[model samples]
Target chain A: GENVGLHLPTLSVQEGDNSIINCAYSNSASDYFIWYKQESGKGPQFIIDIRSNMDKRQGQRVTVLLNKTVKHLSLQIAATQPGDSAVYFCAEKSGAQKLVFGQGTRLTINP
Target chain B: EAGVTQFPSHSVIEKGQTVTLRCDPISGHDNLYWYRRVMGKEIKFLLHFVKESKQDESGMPNNRFLAERTGGTYSTLKVQPAELEDSGVYFCASSRSGQLGQPQHFGDGTRLSIL
Candidate 1:
């Protein structure tokens, strides 16, 4: 079965350090990918997105790198802050309108 | 502009009871989606609606769950004879268009507890 999965369940980082969360997707037909941040008791918030046609995309303090050959996706956060602590999910646009999400990586930033 | 809004932020129901979750998507957003996160599990897509029609419902767990989006403004998800395993947080999201790669704005979600 096709699914999206995370490389790690949790990631701990010190404040001002960089954080990278990795994901692996099995479906090669997926063309669009997105990263979302969800705090405890809240819905997932959109962070950044990348299309399979491109290898990389950048946002404020965040970057998403996609590798089609290995079907790997990564989200990089620069200068991790306390507020950046949350569960980060990587989702792929499956089929027409549905998005399949990865297991997610709990990002913990220590001050 | 208001984001997606869900009613009854939390719902508690006994097994075999019925519960309906409501979602009011962002105004003029023609695309709406329903998703769920079970305990200790990642969020999963349930279904999607493009206006008043169902776009895709492949993710719906079973026939016990019924979703309707009349008038294409607000949508409702009804679970009949809910089971203990039905306990989870239901989230609603909306996007300006149903086009591929469009970002979906989400609501806080309705927590449903079936005891």
Candidate 2:
């Protein structure tokens, strides 16, 4: 079965440090990848996205790197802040419609 | 502009009871979707609606769940005779188009607890 998964369930980073969350997908046919951040008691919020044709994309203080050959995706947050603490999810667009989300990685920031 | 809104932020009911979740998407957005996240599980897609028509419902868990979007505005998902396994956060989202990679704006989910 096709699935998206994360390398770690939880990650802790000190404030001002960079954080990296990794995800792996089994479906190679996926054409789009997205990163969503879900704060406690909130729905997933779009962070950044990348198309299959691109290997990397950068947003405000975040970046998404995709490796189609290894079927892996990663979200990088520069200068982690306490507000950046949340569960980050990596999702892949299946076909042209549905999105398959990874199990999510809980990111904690130490003040 | 206001973002997506969901009613009754939380609900607690006994097993075999019924619960209905409501979602109001962003104004002028024609595409709506339903997704849920069970305890310790990934957020799973429930269905998608293009106006009043159901575009894709392949992710709906079972017949116990019914979703409808009348007049192409607000949508509701009703779970009849809910079971313990149905306890989760139901999230609603919307986008302007049904395009492949359009960003979907999401609302705070409805937390349903089946006792």
Candidate 3:
């Protein structure tokens, strides 16, 4: 059963514009969340992460907001660039190093 | 330090054949992990290794799958008589801190296609 899924499978934004991607998780027991960026033909690169305790965390040009009340997570990119075009994933960490990733959201930057 | 690296970016073979996937983690990383994403499925955990020892292997699909992390420097996953269901992307990751739930660096996955 796919418990983790995004509201949108794809999102497109203009260059220099902001982009937001949302994700919904089914498990209430998940205590940690992380955001990753995956480019074509490459492994996922860690972006930012937020714990259940913190509602928001900021890193570089990206920010991760967590809403534990609704089990929702979102990633926001400022002034999205062409290099930012890739599949974005939200993952939940249960107990150990195991991460359950969402379906994934492909973000495209239109120049 | 160089990040994790996996060999044979892609593979294709008929069913009932054996295949092996390898992963080389970061220089000082002590935690190594294996995960797979089957067709139309999420990335599922395959196993975890901490310093040449298996910590968790609860996600391995069946007995045909064997994973080893000798010397804790690198890891290998072997699939014997692999079935068609084994066709998918296998990803390996590692972390510097051998703690549970740490941020993991990944290797470009190996996409295995079984006919």
Candidate 4:
């Protein structure tokens, strides 16, 4: 069986601390990268997005860093709260093609 | 503007039963799309509809999944004879257009459990 897909590594952080979730994308041609958050029994909510032209972008309490050099992207959450605990996914889109997503990283915040 | 909306937050049905999920995108948005996330898997694109026509449905898993957007408004996805592997969350989203960077607003999703 051929393995190695778009799965991401899980990240765990304590409440009030910072958390960083990383993802490695497959397609270098992907022009835009987005970060989404999904809580239990809920859908993925838009967090922030950055293009291949930029290295970083930020929102209220979260920031997305794109390292095109290594095809690596990451989301940094500041002062992580339990409410922010959820499954975080990184999605890549090229042109008008369908958006492709990583396997998702479980962000567990210990309270 | 109102966000994308989906019907029946959750649905549980026996295998081989049929189920339908509905979605209403933000008003005036011309591009609507459907995505699905299976258990322990990444979210996969199902199809795209521009107005009342299906622009792209390359990701549709099989023929059992039927999608329609009548009158270029709300849309529906019908899954016939649902299988155990069909249990998962289905999401609907809409974008201003199919540009490279346009963001797609998503619905909360419908959780389907095939027993």
RMSD per prediction, one decimal? 3.7, 3.7, 3.3, 3.9
Candidate 1: CAPRI quality band:
acceptable
Stretches off by above 4 angstroms in model 1 are: A1-8
Looking at model 1, residue A74 earns an lDDT score of 98
Better-scoring candidate (lDDT), 2 or 4: 2
Q: Which lDDT values do the candidates have, in the order given?
A: 0.90, 0.90, 0.87, 0.88
Question: What does candidate 2's lDDT look like per residue over B1-115, in tens digits?
Answer: 9999999899999999999999999999999999998876788999999999999999999999999999999999999989999988899999998666688889998999899
Residues A20-96 of candidate 4 have per-residue lDDT tens digits of 99999999899999998877666778899898999989889899999988999999999999898788889999766
For model 2 the local lDDT of residue B73 reads: 99
TM-score of 2: 0.94
> Candidate 4: which docking quality band?
acceptable
Model 2 lDDT, residue A35, Cα: 93
**Per-model DockQ:** 0.46, 0.46, 0.45, 0.42
Q: Model 1: DockQ against the native?
A: 0.46
Relative to the real complex, the DockQ score for model 2 comes to: 0.46
Which sections of candidate 3 miss by over 4 Å? A1-8, B98-101
Across residues A63-105, which tens digit of lDDT does each residue of candidate 1 receive?
A: 9999999999999999999999988889999567888888888
Query: For candidate 1, what is the recovered fraction of reference interface contacts?
Result: 0.63
Candidate 4, chain A: TM-score against the reference: 0.89
Model 2, span A1-111: residue lDDT tens? 111233438999999999999999879999988899988788889999898989999999999999999999999999999999888889888675678888888899999
Residue-by-residue lDDT tens digits, candidate 3, A31-58: 8888888876677898988888889989
